[model samples]
Target: MLKPKRTAGSRDLAAIEMRRSLAQRIKELTEEPGEHLTPIPGLSLYHRTSPTPCFRASYEPGLSIFVQGRKRILLGGTEYLCDGWSFLLSSIDVPAQSQIIEASEKTPLLSIFLRLDMPMVREVLSRDDIPEGPPSAHRQGLVVGETTVGLLRAAMRMLELLDTPEDIPFLSPLAHREILYHILRTPQAGRLRAIATSGDLVQRTGRAISWLRENYAKPLHMEALASTARMGVSTLHHQFRALTGMSPLQYQKQLRLQTARLRMLMDGFNATTAAYEVGYESVSQFSREYSRFFGLPPIRDVKALKNVNTALESVV
Candidate 1:
């Protein structure tokens, strides 16, 4: 791909340095194949080969960038992919499944995950000259965007702090803010701007999502949720579906099933118990839905996941 013309400014110089640093950091961090490393506070980096087609998992507000290979994510039946030149940004909580689709032993997939903290979001929003109005609603929680010089640079600086632990306490937050600024100034800024703003429809929808995440197993009333989000029931339903591509009920169901699967796999709960814990009342209904969602019966699915974990441990 042809390089975009670089501007002649100090920011440009800093951006170049930043990109070089990021590329080097990614190379060093990804040196070992099949390793997942959490290099810094709230940042998880990984290099993988032959990763499974992962199920839709609850995604916290975060930024995800792939330095090599590719990732495909499915959200609300929509598919999105990001590769070396692209990044995926989720500005709010979402239910999605993602997998490294283009990696092998010869060339492992490389990626980084950054946690989104509300304090930093507020700090970024506090700056003067804030952009006004709600950004257009985008249904896909994962968005693939062309990686810019600015963002690449900030990402590198953030990783560079890993080598200088002392600076992390002071510099990491600033670098993170720069990264967010880079994002807000990009073409996809509108989507993020919507997320950054307080009391916007998107942010309101985000509140509802947060509540469901914490109370997935508990029964929910539409009006109650609407009230919590500060929107009327009808408007909440319309905007929620517009932003997530699923009605509130569908979103809750996805969360319920995903959480139930985790309870079974990680906590070793029986299928019936897991289903009930996740708020499913009928064991038969749970079994049928679990099978449909996971493409295997609950017992078999748990067993398969355990086998996979065991095999990975053996290799390690």
Candidate 2:
């Protein structure tokens, strides 16, 4: 097998130094304890001063570059740990549970999150220079890959634009493109390319997933979903599970539960109110499943989550 011009071994030494450089800039820019949106569109810096409780999160199509500490995320049955050496590419919107596994006031978890430009990715994939590889069997929306020197360099340059605000207007887009190019150069690009392509099976499955995400509260009809994806019922089910690791019903259930949890926790809704609001017909059914899913009854879970942040307050 022919390797790319910059092999894995070649990028290692430089990537180590580059990660340190990027981490410093990110930490300095994100003085607050949460995600800080940058001047550049679709880019954000995250800083966590302490390990956190597992929280439900929805990851849009983006890249998460971790430069310090670690995070553990569970998507379906798979558990992924992202530390300083790696990055996670989300080719589609995915619901998961994530927690900060490593961090402290002295050494915070520093990361850069940049949303993908599917059009830009498609443009790069169209270039004559990018060789067509054999079809990849990989279909998961989220994939982890080693952070290369090129990726770190691109992210650092993007972050630097924060200092010179004027340059960001003209230069940030170029930096964003550069970051996308580095992502395409990795093996995980195969999954990204599938989503970017117009009519690929994975892309079709992505459409159904998107529909499910947007309309999870509505009654699900397999025929309508298969029609949306331009796939037969069996084919849709197979490809959907292949790409998302969850059946459509299972996916919708999780989405409903997470949304209900958020409403109750953040919006001050009660258990019964939150249940019916998220399309549940019965409060008893919602409570039963909520306990099974979150390991606590609704009121208790919300109460526990409220206190979960107390640990971080001490560090502040």
Candidate 3:
């Protein structure tokens, strides 16, 4: 028996239905307005009732898909905006600022985040079925792309495991693999592939990044960094800047400033204490740098952040 041919209209309708299904499932999983961690490892859901102040945080390698509303992420000097039909991928650990740009009490921002498993990514790449692409040298570690039905369906199924807890152990891996497979085939594949490819400049830059992260408080020696990355000094500087959009020293400064802010905000450390703790030799220099980075002096910024938190707590 011959099967009926599918029409373009039918395909369009099916895509619409899938989007609706994804939105419904995501909303169901995120019932309240907060970050919700799930039973599955490295999977989380987020919701917000209104527009939020820009948030500075570091993102590990992961994928974030918004089912409702929009977000803007700032990496160094670049800005990326994504809506319900789009997704963002961070191929490496990066410190960035992001904010929910579109949301309301009635139609809050709902989103899901899945951390990428590098081992699984390598496994997929090792398969002979996967196609090869030109190696990318200067691609940033972050990418935003419009979503497709196949990717949406896979993500929805991964979320569905939240309701069917019993099936998660067996089915979650498969769902995650499917999601990665779709991502690998996207235009961002070259950058993503380069992150995992051995001896690639991006991978070497990543090694340098890892060392900086681990030794951020120590004095930065250019020769040491170049040796750690197994690259020449000039190549390390150029490739590191190309991949991360900042010089190594600038990146270290970001790490130090962010860490100091967290210590002051969360650990009740004072400006001088926090500054020195993160390797700032001079309190005045720390204050100057902190003000430049966070738009206020250390003491004032901490007070402002505390007030914002207090206001949010009162609202909640």
Most lDDT-accurate candidate: 2
Candidate 3 C-alpha lDDT tens digits along 73-138: 877677888777677878677767777878776777888899888888899999999988766553
Candidate 2: where are CA atoms >4 Å away?
A: 1-13, 198-204, 228-230
Candidate 1 segments whose C-alpha is farther than 4 A from its true place: 1-24, 27-44, 47-50, 102-106, 116-140, 304-316
- Every candidate's CA RMSD: 5.4, 4.1, 6.3
TM-score of 2: 0.85
Q: Against the true structure, what is each candidate's TM-score?
A: 0.75, 0.85, 0.81
Ordered list by TM-score, greatest first: 2, 3, 1
Q: If ranked by lDDT, best first, what sequence of candidates would result?
A: 2, 3, 1
lDDT of 2 by residue, 230-278 (tens): 9899998887777667888888888889899989988999998999888
Give the worst 10-residue stretch by lDDT in candidate 1.
1-10
Q: Give lDDT per model, in order.
A: 0.74, 0.83, 0.80
Candidate 1 per-residue C-alpha lDDT over 1-316 given as tens digits, one digit per residue, 9 for 90 to 100: 2112233562455554654466557768667765455546678786776555466566677787666677777787787777766667776777777666677665557777888776787778777875643464555565666667778867887887888888887887888888888877766676666555535787888889889878888888999999999999998898787667788888888888888888888788998899899999899998998889889998998899888768755654
Residue 301 in candidate 1 has what lDDT? 87
- Candidate 3: RMSD over Cα atoms? 6.3
Best-matching candidate per TM-score: 2
